[model samples]
Target: MTGEPEGPDFDVPVGLFEDIEDLKAKLARLTAQVEALTGGDGAEPGEASADEGEAAGGEAAADDAEEEEWQYPPFILLLDPPEYDDELRALIEWVEGVLVPGYLAEPSADARWCHLWWEHPVAIARLHAVWLAWQELTDPASCGYTGPSVWHRDHMDPALRELRGSTGPFAGCVKGEHQIDHRMPGLVPSAWTHAED
Candidate 1:
């Protein structure tokens, strides 16, 4: 009579699960902080709203919990993650009404961003930051025309450094200082896009 515990017995660090839960809570707090800083509240980003969160019953809740570990930040900006839907609608209108038609092609391909890039999580999140800053910064009375300059220096520059760095979205695709080429619709960083790896 072998007394081995079960089929998949594995050594785990004591209190590891507790530690992980603690980390998740901390991360959720940070996410909430970012949301608050950017004007949001309640749970973290990418989490479900009240209906989806509560209506999950049982199986759906587990499924959501499973996926929650992997989801990038949702493309939402507001006081609540539940507002993601509304913000997405607004973002769609803005992108379609402004960013796309006038921005599809640029003077330099390196500066080109695919409208489809909106589908990428990183792009969505980064652009959300830019858009939010633009909203407050571009108020004519706030900073005058220098608003855009401030936003570019504060937000856009940092985002671009990551989004277009040597190892960023256009990594391996950027030809030189002035000519990044994208063969595909999305320009996600290889690290984030290559989940299979």
Candidate 2:
């Protein structure tokens, strides 16, 4: 009896193994180049050439600087006189184009909205907060697939509720109306205040 099996001969495609080896060589070269660029002496990237303690301290300082820079200022704080107009224009575009059309529903007594919302400082602040949160949350790089839902639940819904409530800045406003005379009530007189002279 013959030792060889009688099944059809199996063979790998020509040059397949060579191609795989070529890819591996290319990958190794790229990895080595990246390591060289990133300071591949088993040290973290951007580690200083100084002593160990000095490097550690430097890293800490860099981290602190990054944290400080990362702190986001509120909309009111972002109003540098030079950049005010441009910033406001961008905000208005987002509000009118994306926010109003996508999220805001028909304004009612329970949920008031002013057409000239920018005139109200409180409305501007609230809307800016919402916009910032939206920017952070809706970005796939910042937050994963569920970011939009999280923004809706944690940021947009609450801000809108407060901003559009009956006691909100738009209290004097309604659908199809913008109250030119709308004014936020002033605080009660202080104890030192006296009768007009």
Candidate 3:
């Protein structure tokens, strides 16, 4: 009967099943490696990756949301002239009674007051006027015999001498030249009396 081995029966594809099994085993190994790397400490592998991504995103958002830095302005405190002794005293009283208390109670109020004092010319002028009024009140004899001179030359002369010794071009000028022009020479006027027009 035709016994030539029929050419080795070539119907099935060569190595097809072995290739499929090999690929399945490789996939399983890869999955196991991923699980080992990510799945520890009771958390799923995917959850850790998600959490890390969220954290990175939050940091980026925070960086983007940063604000500009702030800066402070410069300032100075001005003192009244000695001639305005009455006004200075009044100012000290006002500061002690109203300003210091307000500032202590609310820092923002002090800041606002400073801003107003710097920005408003009228406020500065008002302060100057107060000082002028005080100076006039403290030494009523400044305008000569036109009004009663309550200020004593004995006391004022020494003050003038002391002022002359002070350092500056205008120091001695107050008593040496200016005093002669502004001294009170008659009876002392009442506190309420206004100078003759």
Candidate 4:
């Protein structure tokens, strides 16, 4: 054989990622590699293969119904409003009982609890993603890979960085710029005060 490299793009230049598309392509490749190694599946119930489909189609009709009952964007926070659904009651209980008092309420954290943010749709969505990431990286029953290091690297860091970032949902609310009213804020969004002028 002649003196030549064996694989595709064997002569790729060092600065190939200087292009936006090339950078995106490289990122996609990296993400795929990580997913392959870590067993990360896509985000929907029906996103699995035919063999997996048969499993979800089993005697878990109630489970399927629950999944189908979910709203457009499946943020756990949205389950709290309208004040009647039993699922909402449970979600609120879990957040208050576990998520908030344990993690979000910490003074050492870069994140400060925003009781009124659940009212904002965008905040609801972002925080829901964080919560999902928490479930993925923490719950011992989950099948995929997990660890504090992995959680911080893949989930916790990005979620907190975005949610508690300078221009995030708490943009003006974190500092003294716009203050949350201290008039007895509680678990419910309505109980919390807004940053209204």
Candidate 5:
């Protein structure tokens, strides 16, 4: 006759609530910063900005809703320094605070890594992709009960293998050393170079 649900109790991960709150605070601050930089009037995010008049308020609201909806930019690698700086800092914070300590194994010959991972463009792109997936897949409202597991199995694992694997972008660097001049192999020379020979 007891009607208390029968499923095993799900223990929320330690510090998860704190992490969500922190992310919310950071997002708010970043939103404000962006607004200031873009000459916005400091309106709350997603709040449509328009004159509140008896006759025109509704139409203005609808139009402003579409116009002012904030969207996170993708492809940090494609952004300029000013555009990507904040995003890069956020990614760095997450990597250092969570990803490295929680998920990464010790660096070794087989699991190569670089201290200056940001110096490697490909590594930055890959890590950014992983971070994006992490944000979406870890959100309970966005993804169902299997969110975290899906993030780990699909996003984190593949990214870690690609980024830290022996032949990855960090292949030329090591745990304590960063190759100052490391670069991806250049494109093959013009096919016509040999035509003259």
Candidate 6:
């Protein structure tokens, strides 16, 4: 009008945006519409629902209850002298029937037989029998070989191939700096006698 360049208004109408608050309301409406179109129900992005939490909690509680209900009994090894004797005899018969034959039949008979010197089934059975006899003969209260000392680590059987390796009980006694001697010397008979030893 006043000798000014009359330019045509190029601004397009971008809906009913009046003030800053009105613009914010329009933006929120558009966001909701976009969310609905894109399969959003206003739930948390990555968190599980209330029902899922309840189920998980129930399962955890059930597992805890099961664990709480579990029980274990005390193990009894040797109760009385009579029971010990019976068990010892049974164990001996089992060794004689099962282990002795297998030992005799093994190939490399000399090496295998000599190896059995450390831990023979027959010898173990005899040892068990002797322990039972000792228990019967001596007073239970005054016996030196009371509780589990009679079946201690040293008295137990050595592993196979004990002569080759430094791992077995025999190796510990023989090779190591320990003065290991047979209690009864000549009384304790040797099972296998190698020519060298």
**lDDT leader:** 5
* lDDT (Cα, tens digit) per residue for candidate 6, span 1-197: 59999878768455533444444444444443344445475435322233333443554434433533442211114335676456655655644554445433442422333333324333444445444443443554334446344433333233224422343233323322232233334644353542346
Given candidate 2, what's the lDDT at residue 72? 51
Query: Is 1 or 6 the stronger prediction by lDDT?
Result: 1
Reference-based lDDT, each prediction: 0.57, 0.69, 0.37, 0.51, 0.72, 0.40
Encode model 1's per-residue lDDT on 1-197: one tens digit a residue.
58965666678887997767645544544443365345454655555444453444455455556656663344364336557767766777776786557544442335534335555556667767767787778896546888978987898678766665545554444323222334356653465545675
Q: Pick the candidate with the highest TM-score.
A: 5
Kindly list the per-residue Cα lDDT of model 5 for residues 1-197, writing each as its tens digit: 59877977779897997777645544444454466456585556444223321223444344434545656567898888777998899999998889889977789998887877887888889889989988888888668779999988998889889988877888767777676345446634343853685
Q: List the residue pairs that clash in candidate 1.
A: 40-79, 41-79
Model 6, C-alpha of 30: deviation from truth (Å): 63
Candidate 3 lDDT, 125-144, residue by residue in tens: 44444333334545533354
TM-score of each: 0.39, 0.56, 0.17, 0.41, 0.59, 0.22
Predicted candidate 4 versus true structure: per-residue lDDT over 66-169, tens digit per residue:
43445333555445555424544444565567666765644223564456665544555665565556666676534345554676677656766776665566
Worst 10 residues of 4 by lDDT: 45-54
The whole-model C-alpha lDDT of candidate 2 against the native structure comes to: 0.69
Residue 114 lDDT, candidate 3, scale 0-100: 30
| Count of clashing residue pairs in every prediction | 2, 0, 0, 0, 0, 0
Which portions of model 3 miss their true places by more than 4 Å?
A: 1-112, 140-197
Q: Which ten residues in a row have the lowest lDDT in candidate 6?
A: 70-79
